[model samples]
Structure formats: structure tokens, C-alpha cells
Target: MRAIAPQPLLDLANVSKMFGGVSALSDVSIRIPEGRIVGVIGPNGAGKTTLFNVVTGAFRASSGAVTFADEPITHWPSYRIARAGIARTFQNIRLFASMTVFEHLLVAQPHQGAGIRRFLPARRADPEAWRRAEEALAFFGLAAYRDRIAASLPYGIQRKVEMARALTARPRLLLLDEPVAGMNHDEAAELRTLLRQLQDRGLTILSIEHDMAFVMTLCEMLYVLDFGVLIAEGSPAEIRSNPVVIDAYLGSEA
Candidate 1:
């Protein structure tokens, strides 16, 4: 008998989004399988960020369905979507400058309560939460910097801090928007290793990146978009040689 394919961890089915009269995403569909790194690439103004926004509920789609782990989340609020096991990092680092690295992770812990209960002082530090934070710090090589203020860290470390904060949420799927942006080759290389480790630990990652080399080398599959439309989808090798993808974004170098 032929084998059946497993359902994707995240599925976008014929999704489209419009801003005023302008279409930001037009009939785009993609699937991210469990335990794999999937990449989305496009030129500037190609709606890559908009696609992320729609998936995370920053904006509602004009048409189509989004399902995560078999649950429909297309119309869910941003916070609701986040609480439903999705976590994301921004294209630009969004760390709390005045907060220490440890504190950032603490705030990301889910189900701490609400209203006055939320404000109730912890009688003592939650040992489990702190342990998780420490593990994340060590994993990202930021344990020594845990007590340091986020703004004081080097740019690459700040990016790691943001990623660490997201991991503290214990998300089922992580969305990274340009996670390697503004990094030197050495920094990017270091991050590449960290990402691979995360995947090995069973985290499902879907990322948007302009760093073609990084995306090509790291992602198992690639999706290319242009002017809000998906133009191509393939393995990295196929993407690297696709004439349409090259003309639209990769240029002659690809």
C-alpha cells in the first residue's frame, strides 16, 4: 500500500489579505510539516511580513483558512493565537531594553493568571520557571549575561535574548522574521548552529529571511513570493536554480 502523508503542523489554505484596495497577499497557500525548518523568501514589498502578520493574527485574512495543529485559528485574536502554541520574533529585535535577560524569559511564561491575581507578588521565585530560563540561557550561550540589561548586550546577543524569550513560552511552532538580520558572518554562523540545535530538540520553525545564503543552507524547503503572490515552491537546490525565482529576487548570483 502507498503511504499517506502526515498532516502539516501549520497550514495556510488559499489565504489572501488586502490593505484598503491593495492586496498584500493573493491566494497564497503553504504548509509547514512537523519538525522541519521551512523558509519564505521574497524581495522587499513582496508581503512576506504581511503573511506572518496574518498567520499570527496581527491582521485578519480577507479570505481563506489558517489551521494550526488541526485547529482553525484564522479569526483568532493575536493574543489568543499566541496562547494557542504559536510564538514569534520580529524582523527587528524587540527586546525590553531596561529588562534583564532573565526577566524577559520570566514574562514570557504562560498562564501566570490575570488582573489582581496576576499582580500578586510571588511568595518565592518559581523554581521551574527559573530552571527553564536558565536552560534557555545556557542553550543560547547567554547564561553569563542573564543578569545583564538587554540593551547593554551586543546586537547578536540581543537577538538571541529575543529568541530565548520566545522559547520560554514553550511554543509548538516558532515563527522567526529575519532572525539573522544585521549580523556579521561570524554571528550568523553562530546563530545557524543554535537553530540547528533547536530543530534537533523537536521545535518546528517557519522563518522569513532575506539572507539567501543562510536560508538556502538551513531550510529544507523554500517558498518564494513576489508582489504578494507565491511564485515558486521547492527544495533549496531547486529554488537556487529556478529561473523565475532568480529573476524575481535571487538575481544572477543564485
Candidate 2:
């Protein structure tokens, strides 16, 4: 008897994106297995961010399909896609400067109900939302910073606050864009630990990062893109040795 293949948590089949005459992605395909960390790496203008935008519904693909949890989400609006359990952080920190860390988390919580109930002012604090927010703060080691203004924290701590906010959405899959972009070595190491903790908690992640060391160590598998095309996909070790990747992205580092 043949074994059945496990369905991917997210799958992109022959996806293509174009901005007028210029192609940002062409025939790109990838599968993110459930509960795994997958990395996408490329040089500047390699279309990594374009792929993310297409998947998250920020831009509809010019052609091909995007499916999440076995459902086709090709034409869904950005808000609908987010509501369907996909959450992401931007390449740049997107925290509300004036808001407290705790407040940021609170605002990210998905509200229950619809119509009048949704629009009506809450008469009381939402216990569930508060509980989730507190848990996220503690999990990310930001409990003490809960009342601190987001802009006043250190850069590393601000990144954690942004991640904590994403977590409050209770997503099954997390998308991170340059998550450790501005961190020092120690901060990056701390973030690596936090990412593993999140993975262990059953959250699957798809990340696009320029930090080669971080991604190579954290990701189970990787996809390499160049000029809107997927040139390779494999384990970190395999990718590190691929001559095409070395030439296009890694350069002398390889």
C-alpha cells in the first residue's frame, strides 16, 4: 500500500506576480508543512517581499494559486485573509509609538461577534482578550515592559512587542519579514530562542530574512529566489553549497 502524503499548511502553486510589464515573480512554487519553519532568501529585488504580499492578499497574483490549510485563498481580500488565521510582521517595525506594549497586544486580539455587537462599545473589559494579551507578554519576556510606551523601548524589545502583538491574533501560521533586521548578536540569539519556543507551541512560520546565519540555523528548509524565479529549494546545508545561490546571493560568504 502507498502512504498518504500530509497536506501542507500552506502551498503556493506556480504563482506569478507582475507589475505592468515587469514580473516580480514567475512560476514560483513552495510548500510549508504544518508546524515547521520555512525560510525564503534572496538578494535585493529578488521578489521575496512580492511573494509575501501575494500570499497575504496585499496583492493578488497575476496567475496561479495560493492555498492555506487546504483552502484556496487566491482572491481573498487582505482583511479576510488575516481573519482566516494568518498573521505577519512587516520588514520594518510597525508598532504604534504612543501605545503601551500591553495596549498593542490588546488591539490585536480578534473580537468576537458581528454587526451591532461588534460595533457597540464594550461595557466591560474583555477577559479573554486580556488573558491572551498577558500570556503573549509573558511568553515573549515582555511582561515587565507591558506599561512602557512602544517607542521608548530598546529596538530589540520593540521587535518583541511587535511579535507579541501578532501572537494576540491566535494565528496558526506566522509570517515574519526581516524579523531580526536591527538586532545585535545577543538580541538575535534571544530572538532565536523565542522563535523556537513559538514553534514548539505549534505555530508554523514562513520567514523572509536577510540575516543568513539566523535563517540558516532556524529554518528546517529554505527556498532561494532570484529575479522573480525560484532557483533552488532544500535544507540549509544543501542551500549553502548550491553554486547558483552562492553566486546570486551568498557571494564570498559561501
Clash count per candidate: 0, 0
Q: Candidate 2 — which residues are off by over 4 angstroms?
A: 1-3, 119-125, 252-254
TM-score of each prediction: 0.92, 0.92
The window of 10 residues in a row where model 1 has the poorest summed lDDT is: 115-124
- lDDT digits (tens) for residues 1-254 of candidate 2: 63498889999999999999999999999999999999999988999999989989999999999999988999999877887889999998888878999889988875645545445443234667878888888888898998889989987788888888888888999999998898889888987887898899999999999999999999999999999999999999999999999988899454
| lDDT value, residue 115 of candidate 2 | 45
The lDDT of each candidate is 0.89, 0.89
lDDT, model 2:
0.89
